[model samples]
Target: MKKRFLGYPNWWGEMPMAVYTFIEKHDWEGRTIVPFCTHEGSGLSGTERRIQSACTGAKVLKGLAVRGSAAQHEQESVRKSVSSWLEKLHL
Candidate 1:
């Protein structure tokens, strides 16, 4: 976390514990962090806001929260959601 990731500009994937730990321990002065999460029904659990608060000076783009089951049973829907989110973030 304190160590820079160097060439990376952004982070993705369901907000894994490792990412949470990294954010908590790091100072993302010039980076952008996106925290997405998958759940049974509970959504992001506020990790996005928390991430923004934790990573000072970082550009924390809006996060994505999707249900875990959707990926297995509704692939196209998940694809659309991801596509839209990426577009909205201009990523």
Candidate 2:
């Protein structure tokens, strides 16, 4: 058997339609989903719930939201934040 991982996404405009469509098209049962995104200000406003609603059988972990400006201009800090978040989850 093999394992797969989906990299973090960029959340925008309250609900990211592509992410929603991806979720809707796939079978997420028996999987772990950790949602992290960068946004201008929406800041993961409704994506977590959207993901939950779409993939009911998957385990959705707490999501991390970083400002889009920070993600673009503050690479080191974003890296640190992601590293710290992963550590906390023991990933």
Model number with the top TM-score: 2
Clashing pairs in 1: none
TM-score, per-candidate, Cα-based: 0.72, 0.81
**Pairs with backbone N, CA or C atoms under 3 Å apart (clashes), candidate 2:** none
C-alpha lDDT of residue 62 in model 2: 76
Error of 2 at 1 (Å): 12
Count of steric clashes across candidates, in order: 0, 0
Instruction: Tell me each candidate's RMSD, in Å, in order.
Output: 6.6, 2.8
lDDT (10s digit) by residue, model 1, range 1-91: 1223211112242355666676677658988776566677667666667677778887776777777789789999999999998889776
Off by over 4 Å in 1: 1-17
What clash count does candidate 2 reach?
0
